[model samples]
Structure formats: structure tokens, C-alpha cells
Target: MTIRFPTLSFAAVRAELLARREIALLDVREEDPFAQAHPLWAANLPLSKLELEAWRRIPRRDTLIVLYGDHAGSDLAPIAAQRLAELGYTRVHVLEGGLDGWREAGGELFRDVNVPSKAFGELVEHERHTPSLSAQEVKALIDAKADVVVLDARRFDEYQTMSIPTATSVPGAELVLRVRALAPDPATQVIVNCAGRTRSIIGTQSLVNAGIPNPVAALRNGTIGWKLAGQALDHEASRRAPEAGEANRAVARASAQEVAQRAGVKCIALDAIESLEAPDRTVYRFDVRTPEEYEAGHLPHFASAPGGQLVQETDHQAPVCGARIVLADDDGVRAPMTASWLAQMGWEVYVVEDHPTSARQVRGAAAPVHPDAPVVDEVSVTELARHLRESPGTTAVIDVTAGVNHARRHIPGAWFAIRAQLAQAIEAIQPARRYVLTCGSSLLARFAAKDLRSLLKARGSEAEVSVLAGGNAAWFAAGEPEESGWKNVATPATDRYRRPYEGTDAPAEAMQAYLDWEFGLVAQLAADGTHHFHVI
Candidate 1:
């Protein structure tokens, strides 16, 4: 039975959005290709991992979902629509002309992930006139050893990769929390930067909004601008801002709380969060602290969503656009600062005020336990290696790691498979007496093994299933040899997409084109008046 998906035109989709309707504009492609171009509100829900992530991202099965892709004679959109139907989505449609159709309809297409928030940041700067300093001016200040502190507003890993000569890693959300300790003197000029313009502008504005005492400015266009200006960047920089003293923490907390209050962000008690979780409403509880801190201990029912990344990738984290968001942090500073921006971005956001030590806590990978997880059997890496050596053709080894990780390295004989396409993948493989599943950390592998066992059982097959304990990490730690590249793939390698601006091998023209697209986002925002952004 062939299913024909209903198609929605670009004009109709735009009308639905402008009318404040609840619709999920899903770009059913891998992140890399999706990053090349997409509409501002389009969320990347790659068909490869749809089964694993669909239920969590789009919680309401009845929600309106319009799927699109490159669609140059490809079945990606139709296949994705079928998958959504299988998952019980009631209102799913395919975009009429796909990406090309939208482009022809005079719609604005943006490059890179999180285009909506990034474009909004650009719009904010255009409206608010966020202050900035050129790379050359910053370099002159560094040479003269002026009273200035350079704060890299990107993630720690990005700052470590490449940074200004004397910049300290103080990610965007931390600027309000840690700036006072880094610069006690009121006269010390502060500069914030990221890989590009968005984070730099937002970070500088965050401090400015909080009424910080010191003069602050963004490194105009950030590292890309520095490279364009021919300024040398230091690699593997380890400098970081110091922790705040008690007095400074008090001051920062007061300032951030005031800013959040002005932005219409609410502060809620732990007990009050439950009332917000009724069936009629969707509420996301997040710990907006660093990953390390969240792992040590965090309140139960809260997912670890580092503040800066959460703000940068809100669509990915909380796909339910109109849902209420509650942020938590042990220190009072981060949540309020993050919530302030989210409120301005038009989210009904809140911060957790009092910390409760009585709540249960979990550690490490934070994998959600499946109800039938205990039924799956487990095998150690050494045992799997021995089984492969003793009975090569009888046992099938499937690596369910992310596509990019599998491409970099994997067990020599394992076939790469997407967890969502388990049944199709198993059918494609030669029938075997036994199967072993593994991923980067084995958390997802356990879930996959349970699913595969149930599927094989329903089919009346005698195949046994087990997960490799500790997964690929244990395989490497056990001194086992591995292979690299996209050979022996059980499914298409489309699970992961390659970014156009990722590595040095990318064409210079593509990189410049991406920048040019970003430069014109303000105009596009004006054309599409759906974004409800208010600059504070």
C-alpha cells in the first residue's frame, strides 16, 4: 500500500506561522546538509535517528508537522513522513517543493544550525546597537598591556581550540556571574568574543543589560573577523576566569535577578514546578549549569542543558516552541542570565530559586531507562572478541554509534546501523544465530538490544541479542584493534551530515557564502514578521 503525503505550499506555511499556529517545520536531513540551508524555524530531525528522538522532541503526536529536504529526485521526505506515521503522528505533511520550492517562493534560507536564534541575535544587534571593537584595536590594547580583560564567550573546547592572545574562557552565560571577580577595578575594559558575531554580540549585551560596572564591548565578528584582519590567534589556550568571592556572588546574584525580573522571567519554587506539568501544557525542566557540575549532582527530573548551548540551540533542545521552560543552577547567577535572554526571545521562562538536596540524583550519561531494559543480556568486549574469533560467520556485530564517530573508528567487523532503522537493517544483514550491539558508551546499545530482541521474537526467529558492555570505549581500552572509514555499513551513512564550514578542506567560497547569508538575516527578519523578539 503506497501512501501519498499531502503537500503544504511555502505561502501556506508562512501564513500558518504568522497566525501563531503550532506547527513543526521539520527538515528531515542530517545536521551537516541541513546546516547548508533551511528556513529560520525549521528543526533538524534527521530521519536516521527519528525513532530514538521523535517521541521526546515532538511530544504531542497530533501536532502539525511539515517535512522537507533537498528533494532533488530523492525519497527522503516521503520516507520520513511514513516513519512519522508509524510513530503515531496524526498530522504530518510534506512540503510542496522542498528546499528549492521555498527558495523559488522568495523565502529566506539561512546557513548553519540554530538559524532562528542566530538570526535573532543579529536582529538584536541591529536594533539595540550592541557596542563592539575591531580585532586590530583589541590587538593594540594587548600589545600595550592596557587595563582590559578579554573574555572568550564560546564553549571551553572552542576557546581552547583558538582564542585571542590573552582571552580567558568565560562562556556567555558566565559573563554576568564571573566578570566581577575577573575585573575588580571599575575602569578595566571588558571584551567578549565567540567564533562569529552572534555569541559575541549577545554576551556583551548580557553584561550591558545586567548593569555591570565595567565598560564592555564585543570583538567585532569574533575569531573569523580576527582571521580576516590577519591577527594571529593562540591555540590550546588554558586561561579561565576565577571563581567569584562571596561578596561578588551576592552582587552578581542581585544584578542578574533584577535583569530577569525586568524581562518578565519568573522565579519558581521546586514544589510549584509540578503544577506547570499538566497534560494541557508542556514544561521542560533544565539544569543550565556546566556538564561537569550537572554530573556531580543535580535535581531529579531536570536534564542537563548548559546555559549557553541551550540559548544557542533552543529549537533543538525544546522543540515545543510555546512550552514553559524552567532553568536550574546551584548558583543563582546562570539561570537568571539565561532566562532573561529566553524571555526576550518570547519564551515563558523561569528560574529555580531554592536548591533542594532531598531530590534524587543521577550521574554520568543520563540515559532514560526503558521499561523493558532489564530483559536484555550483556557481553563484555573480551567475550565478544573471543566469540568472533571462534565463530566468525555465526555472530553478527552491529555498531549503533553516531555516524561521525563510526566513520572515525569502530570495531573491524561491525556493521554501522541506525537505531531507528533496526528492523530494516536486521533484514538486510545475513541471518545469524546471535547479534551483539554496541555504541560509544553502551547506554543506547542496551536500549537497541532490547528493541531488536523483541522484534526478532515477534517474527518467530531464534536469534539471541546482547549488548557489548562499556561499548567501543571498552573495546579500545581492552587493547583491541579497530578500523576507520565508511566501509561495512549496514545502512546508508546519511545518519550524519558533513558541515560546509567545518574543516580547512572546505572551499573558501562556501565559507564566504555562509558569512554573506548571515550578514543579510536582519532584512529577512523584517520580511518575516513572525519572530516576537524584544531587545531589552
Candidate 2:
């Protein structure tokens, strides 16, 4: 006899959300879905975020985690649930019908933040007629000297290799995030491009969704089509914002702090943190610093938790409610931001205060244990590297980077797995193989290898996982046999692409319902004496 698992329907999930007193609503859609309208109180934890920055945002092992995606059949739900569970979350669920289901059920939806192109894609597809500007039309505009700026919505590396001569790199998903910096002149028509249809289709519509005053459209079929049409393309490109210094850190920190304060969030200190520790108390300490910083040194008692993801995935990080929570950071930015979100969840959240001996303490103490490392188990990079050198054939190298980055250059034979997709990807691989995971930097790779092993074990598979000593950046900086982003140049696949948009008052309803659900959770958790609660 086959066992049947319970599957919650859309109405049921929506009802659960409506009845909840407190819950974290995470949307695991692509950046485009999120940029276009999303349910109010919904935060983007793009499926890719898991591999790249999971440990940072989600430090709690038992926080209630509910995720939704664009399509009902979207792969994000299971992927997120699996990753969260591997990371130690006890209760994670997918929204039964995704955003569309909620809307169809008369739930609320919001438009202010919606990405126009995605919405437009749905609209165009709904009408079965997406207007396109032919190369001739673009050339006519260029020859006529029209006031237009072509924006390549691919990554900077891709833009550098080849792009429409009239275009500048603006990368999809990043378009809205960095729009203001790209186009200062609102009057100028913006032309978004990617290698082919999806991103260009989505990027162009995103600008329109955001209500950009300037007229915008995607370059018909992007650079690939442009090249096929025998049109000249430009190879010149530069870093959009090369200066990532104190100012940028300050901005990120300030934004985090502001968000926390606006939400009435608070932080706890170390001494105060100690008071809550007891056999009955479920205390979770998260180190919200960069992987490099955490690996180099971190609070002896803390686990790695990156800030951005911590905010986006609070419940997955901390599952048990009524627990004393402490967040540590070299710079106060991540800690405060994390504290703010946890506080919103009604947890007693605290940021460890600075101490002169902090650095010395971390360095002098035994290295922090990996989250997946058993109580008595210990391993180091040096030991792992030695194993790699000794057993090359048995080893598997997995490059967990942005699709664009992985496509350009990766360790030879390294399988590409975006963070959000890692759980699923790993499940299909050889469990007996030793694995090394990498991303832009080794930090995520380190965290990912540990998490991947946990997932494999949960499914009755045993896999040994290790991190690239320094990740791709480190590999390149050390001058290894590295390939530039120009190594592989296949056009991305667009056959499975689908963007759905449904207009309604559902966003407004969903937002209020979400707020009501959270408000109720505070009361419910408080009434449950077994659970101890504190505002971070």
C-alpha cells in the first residue's frame, strides 16, 4: 500500500494565513515577480538566496516558515522547504496555490511594487500578442538619432563580451534595484535587453510596471537576435558601481536599522543574553557576519547567519518560539537588522555588544563548530583539502553561483547549482561522492556544503561535503587555472518560462490579512505558556 501525504489546498492555506496571529510570509519568486506587485508584508527570499545567503538570514531552527511562489506548480516551494529543513527548520510549508491561488480565492494582491515586464509578460501572453521592435525599427530609431538608451539586462560580464552597440548593462531583477543609478534622465526611452526573450521580455515590462515616466521596450530578442540579424554589437562595458566602501556598508547598515526601528524592533546584549540560558530555554545564537568574517573568526557560541537572508527567512533560522535569541556581528548592521526582524516576530532578540576582547576571544577559543558538525565531530579546511588531493576521482565539485556567473566560468566538471535549487539538485546526485561547493566567494560554499550534507542524510543518503578553500574569488585571486566569464556562451533556455499576472484588490486584502494573522500570533504564542517570547 502506498502512503498518501496531505496536501493543503489554496483556500486552506489562505485561511491558515488569515487565522494566524503571527507568521512570516516569504515569497520565493524570481526578482521580477517581487519587483512587480507582491502581497504586502511579503519579503523576497528568492530561491537562489538559499545557496548564496541562506545561513545569514535564517538563523532560527524552528521559526514558522511559509513560502509562496509565482506559479502554483513553481519549484520554489519544495526547494525552499527542503533547504529550510536541512538547515534545521521544523515547520515549513508551501502556499498551496501560490500568489495566483490567493488571488483566485479572493485574497488580496498589491501592485505598487510589481515588476511591469513580468506583469506585461502575463498581459501580453494573455492577449497572445507581445509587441516587439524589430532590429530594423531599432536601427531606424538609432539612425534617426532618437533619444533612446539601450540597457542590457544581463550580468555585467555577459554585457562586456557582446551586446547591442546602443546598450548599457542594467541586468534584470537588478533593474529596479539600480534603476535610479542607471537612467538619470526620465525622459529618455529605456530599451532593456538580455540574450533572448524571457529577461528582455520581463525586464522591459518591469520598467513599465514601475511606471517609469520614460518610455521603454525590450530589444527584440536581445543580443543573440541582434547578432543573427548581422547587426553590429558593442563589447565595451564597466562596473556599474565599482566603489563598494564604507559608504555602501553604512547605507546597508542604516537601511537595516531603519527598517527595524520602524517596526518597533529591539536588540539584546551578551550579559542579558546569558540570563535566558537554561535547560528549559531554547536559546539560538546567530552570527550575522559575512562567511569570510565568520570563518576567519566569530563568537565561539554563535552559528553563521548572514543578515539579508536572516531578515528574509526568520522562521527557518529560528523555529522554536519563546526562545532567547542573540545575534552577533563584526559591524552592527546585520545584527541590528536581524534583531529588528526577530523582534517583529515577537522574539526576545539581542545584538551582542562590542567588547575589546571580542577578536581575541574568538581567535583564542577553539574554532566555531559547523552547524552540521556533530557535537564531537570536527574538521578544518586544511584537512579537507588534503583529502581532495588524495582522492580526486571520488570528488565532485559543485559551483553554486548565479546562473549567469556559472554559465560564464566555473571549475571544470563542477555542476552548477543555484542556492535556491541546491536542495533539489543535490538530491539527484551521487550520495557516496565527496563534494566541494563554491560561489562568488567561499563563504556561501562553506555553508552550502554543510547544508547539502544534512539534506542528503535526511533522505537516507550519506554524502561528505566540503567547501572550496577560498571559493571562486579566492581561486581566481590566487591565479589558478581559472576561466573568465567568456568561457561558455550558450544562450539561456527560455522554453519553460511563464509569467502570470492577475489584477485585483487581492493585494490589499492579503496585506491586511497578513497583519491580522501576525497580530493574532502574538496573542496565541503568549497564551501558550510553554513558549517564552521576547521582542528583538
Off by over 4 Å in 2: 1-48, 51-65, 68-93, 97-138, 141-231, 237-390, 417-433, 455-464, 482-536
lDDT tens string, model 2, 78-167?
Answer: 766776676766657766667776667665554323122223233332343434577667877887888877777666666787667666
Clash number for each model: 0, 50
lDDT of each: 0.83, 0.55
For model 1, residues 1-536, the per-residue Cα lDDT tens digits are 56998999999988877765667899987776787778888999876566667877777677788999663356478878987897888889999889999989988877778877888789889888999999899999999999999999888988987888999999888888899999999999999998778889889999998888899999987877777777788989999888888898899999989999999999898889998867545678888888888888888778888888888889998876567899999778899999998999888898998776555266664665222234468898888999989998889989988988998999988889977568768877888889999999887788688778878998999888999998999999999999999777787765655544333344556556666777898888887666878878
**Clashing pairs for predicted structure model 1, backbone only:** none
Give candidate 1's error at residue 425 in angstroms.
9.7
**TM-score for candidate 1:** 0.83
Each model's Cα RMSD: 4.3, 13.8
